[model samples]
Target chain A: MDISNLLKICIKALLNNKMRCFLTMLGIIIGVASVIAMLAIGNGSKQSIRAEIGSMGSNMIMISPGNGRFGGVRQSGSSMQTLKLSDYESIVRQASYIDKITPTVQSSGQAVKGAKNTPTSIYGVNEQYLDIRGYEIASGSCFTESDILHANKVCIVGQTVVNELFSDGTDPLGQTIRFGKIPMKIIGVLASKGYNSMGQDQDDLLIAPYTTVQKRVLAINYIQGITASALSEEYTDQAIDEITKILQTNHNIRIGQDNDFNVRSQQEMMETMSSVMDMLTVLLAAVAGISLIVGGIGIMNIMYVSVTERTREIGLRMSIGAKGRQILLQFLIESIIISVAGGLIGVVLGVAAAKIIALFGTPTAVSTFSIVLSFLVCVFTGVFFGWYPARKAAGLNPIDALRYE
Target chain B: MNEIIRLEQIKREFIVGEEVVRALRGVSFTITQGEFVTIMGTSGSGKSTLLNILGCLDVATSGEYYLDGVSVRQMSKNDRATLRNRKIGFIFQNYNLLPKTTSIENVELPLMYNRHVSHSERRERAIAALKEVGLGDRLTHRSNQLSGGQMQRVAIARALVNDPVIILADEATGNLDTRTSYEVLALFQRLHRDGRTILFVTHNPELASFSSRTITLRDGRITSDIRNDRIASAAEVLAAMPKEEEE
Candidate 1:
């Protein structure tokens, strides 16, 4: 039979039994709606994690001073101040994958500018630290290499610090900020970067030259961490390899002894975060799949009832001239009409649900791939559930069916 | 006239509980092309069984049934359906037109089963069939909207839509009033005049008198076969009938 004619018949048949059809389609509706909503939520969570890790920095490798350990056991601290300004100098000279390196020292204290005073963390580094960490200078120049060599206590304040300290929008240049009884001159301001993935206030900070922080502020640091950039994103692994080899040779730690510091790239961080989200996505999809199976079962039950109710009609059609496959096609088409219609309606409801969730301050994303996949699953459910009842109807003998009063 | 259908020693047995009950036993008959034949019998006299076999709705347990020179026993269920669709049209006593279906759509049902007819052509043929049944104005009326006689007419139109050579009607007038029955018989007469072969099954002898040939069945066997030289015309039978007086 032609599909168009079968479709018309199926539609008319469904229209005649509107209540029954709607009841039958409800299962598919719920299935599709849940699938769409769950997928959207899962994708939203994944994207959030990626964004959080990305905010840390792109291609910025961290070389923390520690021996890599498995489980909870620590074999060694491994480094005796092998990571210093001279070592940073050697990395920039010898490593082909080195982009920029920054030696950092940090201190936390109350910083005062004018009458406004707020307790916040302060970081001391050269100009390269900003580029390595993917931070942009919002308004003023960064602490230069010359300033670091001169041990000039000039500082760059973050936007949050500026808001807390200077509300008049007045240029804070040439102004002195007191931190730990030491007054520092402000030279520039950092741009606002509201929060990172972990909800950390990225804009609440103070930046100053590393030499001043080491000599005058923190006073006892052998460099906490060395932040380095790769020549390109593709060379991150190579950059890590070069940094590890140089650090090992300079520290004179041979194989079998753990290296002094660990080099970790942004891509590794992103992969770890994405793998966790992938697991979550799979779990959500599995739950959605269970609901879809329930939906298929619902379709099967409805179709069985329909076949039994229309036994006389089946007989009549058979006696007239319809083949078994014709009857099968008719019932199958009816089931498909119900399923596909439910799927479409469910998609609309699901997208609306996503929007509502988003409006409630939760992120949601409904991709076209998910929509198309849900629709196809609906159709597949129809066919899968429709087969049994259709076969039963087609296998009915016309003589017995007609005799069925 | 050449024989259009032949049944030789046909037997049909049904398993009722543990025992087998024979519905039709060694029934043999031959019907010529364009002949109007009626099978007359009481309830459970195998008349319906014979009709079912002839209409390809059931296969005989032991029989050699031929339609248009092809042995029906050799054909599969699907092939039988094709033959029924192409050559035999059936009219049931209950007027089994699906409820909520328009008269035109009911009439077009057979043509829809036949894939050779396009949608537009099926509609045209269904309309023409309704017109032939004098229901040109009521083509859009659903089965429930029509009276018993009108519904039966719609059923007849459906049976005739495919232009089959043979029409198998089972108790065609059993549910109608005498006057409506006469009207239906008159319609059958018009169809017969157009050279269509018909096999009607009924218990009413009055209905059998309209056909040129009548076969009487008793206890699953043919008891009598008689051919009438002159059958009463449907109009003559209606003319001799008493009229209902208006209040």
Candidate 2:
């Protein structure tokens, strides 16, 4: 028989019971839609994370004090304070790949500004800390090198500190805020930087000259950490290697001894974060794929029922000289049509769902690869699950089938 | 006349749950073209088995059967199907027309399996067959819309559409009333007069006089095969009977 005639017969048979056919296709629809929507949501979040990390300066590197050993007990890195100003000066003078470097010291305290007190973290660093960490000054000016030399009581405050310390319509620049009875004038207000991927508020901190916090507030000479930016992203690894060697030499650590500090780059962090996101996307897609298999089982079940219901019709066709393979092809074609049509509809629904999700403030991206993959999977489901039932229908004996009530 | 069908010692056995039921036991017959033959038997006489075997819908356990000089027992399953498509037309008892299908589409079903017939030619031949059966005006009517006699005419048109060597009908008029049965039998008689070989299987012995030959089966074996010198014409029988109201 020609394919057209076979298709016509199949369409007619399916059209005989419209409700049943639609119910059979519902499983496939849900399967494909979930697959597409899950992948889109996963991909959207991944892109946004990469963007957030990119904004934190791709070539930036950080160095912190390593844990110290005292009396056979390990002390935490924060309490060690092994990082020093001499080590930072040695890396700045010797490292060729490093373009910017700054010593860092941190202290947390309640800042009281005219009876409006707010608890916030205070970071201490040189003027280059803003450029290295991709922070911008929205208003006023950054403290000059003269201010660091004099251990100036000047600081830069982020948007969150501004909102907490200053009332509405009141200017924050040039205002003095007391940090544990040590008042520091705000020289600049940093621009807004929203929450990071880890849900940490980036704009809820303060920046001041490192020497001021080291000499006046903490009274210790050892620095807490150091931040630096390489000349370019490509030179970040080389810069870390050179700086590590310089620190090892300056700290008098011999060749066999472990260094007293840790060096980390933004590139390494990006690689780790992206790998975790990729694994998550695969996991979500896998869970959604289970629905596709379930949908295939639904198709197989309906096809079996359809064959049993149409036994007399099969006998009639066989009596009219329809070969066994022809009958198999007719039913197989019917299943394939149902699945493919369901897949097409599912693509539309999935994209719409993704768009609606994105509109509600969650990111979503629909990729063509997922669409094509889901469609191919749907076709495979139809063929794989449809084979057994079609074979059973083809193997029916014409005489017995005709006699079947 | 060419001998279209010949059966030699045809035997069909069914293994019904370890019990070998011999449905047809060594039956033999020969039928030629243009013959109106009837095979009659009660319920358990193996007449239905004989008709199934003759129509190529079943194979005898051990027999040598031929159609138009081709050995049927040696033919493969697919070859048998092809031969059935090209050489034998079947009319079932219940007017087995496909439900919800138009009359012309139902008649065109047999030709759909024949690769040599083009699409337009199949339609033309189906229309001609319906016209021959006096159903030309009812081509578009579905099977349920037609009367019992009209449905049988549509079935007859489908059986003739393939231009088969012979027509095998299994109790073709069994479902009709007396008047409707006579009308279908008259149509069969007209076809037989046109030189079409026809075989009608029925258990009603009263219908035997309508055919030119009668063969009776008893207990899986043929008890009698005889030619009737004076066959009753269905038209004459209808003329002599009183007219009935149209149902």
Please state the interface RMSD for every predicted structure, separated by commas: 1.0, 1.1
Model 2 accuracy (lDDT, Cα): 0.90
Which parts of model 1 are misplaced by more than 4 Å?
A: A67-94, A245-261, B14-21, B176-183, B204-206, B229-247
Show the lowest summed lDDT stretch of 10 residues, model 2 chain A: A66-75
The weakest ten consecutive residues by lDDT in model 1 chain B span B238-247
**DockQ: which candidate is best?**
1
CA lDDT of every candidate = 0.87, 0.90
Model 1 over residues A1-405: C-alpha lDDT tens digits? 577777877888899889989988888888899889888988888888787777767688887777645465654543334467767777878989878888877889998876889998888787888887767887768877799999898898888888888887877777888987789999888877788877789889988988888889877657767788888878999999988898888878899987768788888988887888889887997898789889889999999998998888888889889999999999998898889999999899988888889888777888888899999999999999999999999999987777667
**Residue-level lDDT tens digits of model 1 in B94-205:** 8888878899988888887887899999999999999999999998999889999999999999999998879999999999999889989989988988898999999999
Question: Can you give the lDDT of residue A278 in candidate 1?
Answer: 80
